[model samples]
Target chain A: MTLNNFIRIFITIIFANYINSKINFFITDYYLNFTLGFLVFSYWVFTLEEHLYALPSFCIGLSIDLLSGSPFGLNALLFSISSYIIHSYRYSFKIFSFLQVTIFFAFLSMFYLGFIHIFMNTANFSYLLIFLSFFLNGIAWIFIYILMNRFKKIFYK
Target chain B: MARIAPGNTPKLGYFVLIILASLFLYLDIQYKTFTSTKNFFNAGLIATNLAINNIVFSPISNLYKLTNNKLALINSNELLVEELELSKSENFLILNKDKLFNDNSELYKFINNISNDYPHEIATISSFDTNLYKCCDNHRLHLFNNSSPFKKGGTVINSTGIIGQISDSNNKVSEVILISDINHSIPIKSNAFFCNASGSGRPKVLECKYDPSLWKESFEIGRIFYSSGLGGIFPEGIMIGSIISIENVEDGDILLNIKSIANPLTQKNVIVLYPNDIK
Candidate 1:
């Protein structure tokens, strides 16, 4: 038996968030953050059926919000908005080159980081961290994209 | 036949979800409508973590220690640490005995009746996210106090000095708002000036903003600051920190950055000084 679409997306995003939080434990001291969960959500939106994604994405983000210390619904709002945007642009992404897509993801991740910092931690916000992580996330998103595509092959098969 | 791309998907549901989420976020942040929910969730999470540690990890570690013959050494070390903590707390009580009782005759009598035994509870750190502590303004710690419950606004101190105060408490654990959290502030004074030093959101740092025109006193680096007892939460004359740097802001205000003397991360156990005990 195979997992349905909702379960697949839910498990994948949860795993991404868990790994992202664990990775942050070691790197946040150095002023770095990786938005692996957001990346995975965007990828799933691009690949899967899109019309029903907004609700599932919202629900999944609500689950994550419950476990996190951030204000309730912050992640849900962001995930819903991101799902909408990525879904709207999925057709365009099909024709874009790999480098352009990577660049787009890097900038999107930066926006996510910046927005969260503004609402959740305005006092400790650092442009230096956001600036540095842009490059770091750019590199990280490439690895995540490739690795996720490999898993996608197994799931689709 | 081919499936339609997600780009062509309907947009109405997404719009509705976004609006719903935004409403929830606003309500939660503005009115703290979900604070009780968050607290309940936190209490449950801490309980689960403690249960896992006690039921699974503790016995596994004990078995490993029994097989390795290191249990005795570990137990001795733990005993020594406990003794050291107790001694440190005793020293604090002795040092502040006079000041803590000067105003409260009833409390003083109660302390005298107790003899040398001080009234304070030792709480162990339950959960702390160093990542948020280092990177954000919310420097909170979950502390487990199995004894009597910790009262909110009670002062929490380690071996060094004041680390924070109890902000919230439930059945399972108490939440500590560290001095370095942006939302926390302590009324502090030096030789010349008095101001409320707010948390800088940086580890072990607090910032005091004052107008240069109103406060003519000059501040220099390394100048010591002490609690002013204005808020009545913390004891007066206790060492808070020292001025580390000064900067002039856009509105002709002077911002003095203080490096706090107490480091919460240095110890696993903290002593909670209830106001009723001291006042």
Candidate 2:
């Protein structure tokens, strides 16, 4: 990626992490966790042609792991695997309807939540949390998508 | 230009990176290989946070306070009120020294030096994830000690009671593993029965499991728990918490859920007392 794109993605990732942390403070009372940062990362990788490289994805994951209390490389592993998955299905995603893609991302987020919980919070794992987070994350993604589109239009114009 | 699909992208590159990440995750979970790296990062983060608070927030708040002379006076007055509150907490420790250490005279000898003026340094809460504190098992908080360095294993207390002990220290920032943390355990007693109460991973709750057949005394709710001083970490007879509930487990052992008296989130300023210092 060019330096400009690299800087932009880096800032977006950090900002997303910050927002996730702040939002989690309120939503955890309902046993709901939104993997906003991971969703943002996935969204960017799917939309941007310049975001296909696994190295940048890995580096971003490491940055997230550092910022979060999660063990090192947890995000790194997930992000790299996610990049591979997204790249493999890039063509299929083009033909898929918006609702189908949203559901797919929601399932991806549920997997992310379950995987992180196994490693970090095995004692308090609730199936309810996974069930609830899927729908919340799907809605969150829709909002993020619309907001990003509006921001891009304003920027490009 | 269309984005490269996985089938079109170099497959070997992604495989190598995934394998590398797996190795990192394995090493980190197995051996805690990245602890020092994380700690270093945390220390830097704490320092940066402190700098930002001082450079930006403090000045803005100070200027806002300075807008009105009455507000400035009230601010100074609030500072005095805080000092009074701190001393009142210290006084509680001093007055209760006998009650707290009546059973263990050895511990009493150490607490005798708790002076009237200021016996301990006040540490302020630096970064506490109230979200994790409420929802997660790993309950810990970062405390910024601007005065003397904090002693690891020092008892951290607020006006209410014993909160936790210092688990780790990085420069002036220390980590306190709260009694609610799954890894933390404290020896607590009520009247005749004594047991090690482990963190329930629920906020302000500690669990003490005992074989029902072993102890003759029937445990009831609202019974106050006191520090047994078996671990020598906390002062003896200091009120830890009260029994809130009881549960019979599968193994025929009864679990007593004690609601801790001290809530870490309630008090931003805490006093760290090193019992070993006087010893």
Candidate 3:
């Protein structure tokens, strides 16, 4: 990758980290998964960039693990698997419109929450929260895509 | 030449891997052998947290500098001075013979006595897994506070109420199990009855199982519950939560729904209480 691409990636990672901390309000108690997971997962899938996805996912998941004091590989493993699954399907996914990506991400997010629930054996989880998170993820992904698209054109062009 | 189709081997391999990983996770949880693996992952987690903190600190610090004004700063200083003087006068009242009825010293002594009873060291909570069902139990509490005298299995608290017990302790950090964890149970009581209030691991919900025959009518909604001191985990009289509702089950047990007063998300600073009598 060129220097410009490197900087763009770095900035994305930084922005992703900021969001990870700020979005704790939504995820801390009700959702075990980070709200940032939705954003990060979307970013990787939309970019269709496989190589760049894993490290960031690991780093971000690890950061959350430390912040919340959870078992070490738990998040790293979850995030990596989530990103990889999304990455595998990136080629087939039609991302021409925001709504399409939103619907796609909503389904994937269920896997995320479901994985956590099964892992923790927690009961009475609100499906509404999962649905809300999917909606929030859609909004977040679209906004970030627009910003990142702009950055890519300005700097990479 | 004829057309060729892609083999299904890759897809099948991926599925097999997932199934294997799932089984490994289940076994790890059942056998409790993932501690070392968790610690290794935790090292990476700590590094990531530090990096994020460093990145965010600059912008937050810049914002603080941008908004700070001399007048506001001076007012804060003056308020601190006044608060210091007021405490000094309160201290003087405790020392004087004429004001012996108040006995502020006795209050201080009581507090001191309790402090001595449960000597603690500070630990910063690092992370918690919110997932409810992993067999090896993916839930863990990482903390940065390491100098705590209490080891793993020691109890933690804040000024308002009990936080959780210690699950893991290291040189510079410790992990605490929040009262919301299914693994934790504290013996609790009210003014009229006593029972064990178990954490449901669901936020804001606790279960108090009391014998239906004993003081069943006395347990009312909105009544406060306190630590009964029977579990040896918590000190007596610390507020747990209020009784939200009560239900009598066919099993002849009364279940009290307790809504925890402590909000762990907001309460960061906690005291890790270590009993003096730990053998």
Candidate 4:
């Protein structure tokens, strides 16, 4: 990658980390999972150089794993799997509606939230959180996508 | 355009990367392999975030502070309320320090007397895991006081009465083991009715069994019990609790339920007295 592209990727990773920490105040006691990174990383996969997707997805996941104190490779594995699936179906996304895409990501995020709770916080885990996130994730990203579309062009391009 | 999708080599690369990630996940789950890495990254992230937040948001934050007049008043009001509570506790402590005893050593005598009184350290509880306290047999309290050092066996007392004793202590933080712990036992006396009360693993209750035939007189309910100082851990004549109930256990022994006066859950601050001669 060129230095300019590297800088863009670095900036996006930092922004993703910031989002992962902040703006989850809506869910009081639940582990606030923002799937913005997942959403944007998949978008980058579909639009950017496809071969670069998995590596940067892994980087983003590793960053999240370190920060969120999850199992070190859990997010990396999930992101890799998500990116691989996205890469395999890159052409299909062109025809899929925004709602369809949002529905797919909602499950992905719910799995992440549920798995973290099962492995790290079994004593405090509530099944209600996972059930709630399934619906809330779709609504959250739809809003975020509308809000951050302008910035995506600058970073993803 | 061709650079957007790598044909064959990168597909194999992604597979290998995911496999490696799986291996790392196994290692991390089985044995925490990356905790140091996580800790190091966390330290760096916190420092970086703090610096970035201060530099980037300080201007807007200052502007918000300048515009909001209510926040300053609220902050001052909160401080004044907290100070008022602290002063009230101090006044209560001063007035009641010697009032517990029928002796004339009130605030006037305590003010001028140092050699006759046992010095105690006042500490605020910084941390207490309530879940662990209730569920587990081991009950412990973490206390913080920077000025004074606490030692093992120091008697911990709350505003109401005796609560626990310091099991471990350092310069900054100390751990107190509550009397309700199964391991703790206190030599208690109630108007000559003496027995070694054992903790029942229940909060505020201690268990002691006595032979009914030996005494021939039933221990009355609501009778106050005091520490007899036989254990050298607690001072003598301090009120521990009252005889709440009496039960008949197996082997013809009568069990006495001693209800403690101090509840650790209610009290925020406690005093730890180091009485070397109390034994």
The TM-score of candidate 2's chain A against the true chain A comes to 0.94
Best TM-score goes to which candidate? 2
- Give the distance in Å from residue B268's predicted Cα in candidate 4 to where it truly belongs: 16
How much is the lDDT of residue B32 in candidate 4? 74
Name the weakest run of 10 consecutive residues (lDDT summed) in model 4 chain B. B1-10
Model 1 per-residue lDDT tens digits across residues B174-241: 89999999999999988658999999988899999999899999989998888887866776667788
Please give the ranking of all candidate structures by lDDT, highest first, separated by commas: 1, 2, 4, 3
Per-residue CA lDDT of candidate 4, range A11-125, in tens? 6656765565454433424534455656555555545653456677787777767755567998888888877776766656666787787776677678866775566545346
Q: Name model 2 segments beyond 4 Å from true.
A: A154-157, B1-6, B64-71, B81-85, B92-119, B277-279
The DockQ of predicted model 2 stands at 0.51
TM-score of 1: 0.86
Q: What order do you get sorting by TM-score, best first?
A: 2, 1, 3, 4
Interface RMSD for each predicted structure: 4.1, 3.8, 7.5, 9.5
Q: Give the Å error, residue B108, model 4.
A: 19
What TM-score goes with each of the models? 0.86, 0.88, 0.68, 0.50
**Model 3: which docking level applies?**
incorrect
Better of 2 and 4 by TM-score: 2
Candidate 4, lDDT over the whole model: 0.67
Shift in Å, residue B7, candidate 1? 3.2
- Clashing pairs in model 4, backbone N/Cα/C closer than 3 A: A50-B4
| Each model's chain A TM-score | 0.90, 0.94, 0.64, 0.78
Model 3 vs. true fold: TM = 0.68
The segments of candidate 4 whose C-alpha lies over 4 angstroms from its true place after superposition are A1-17, A20-25, A28-34, A49-52, A154-156, B1-9, B48-279
What DockQ, between 0 and 1, does each candidate earn?
A: 0.52, 0.51, 0.19, 0.19
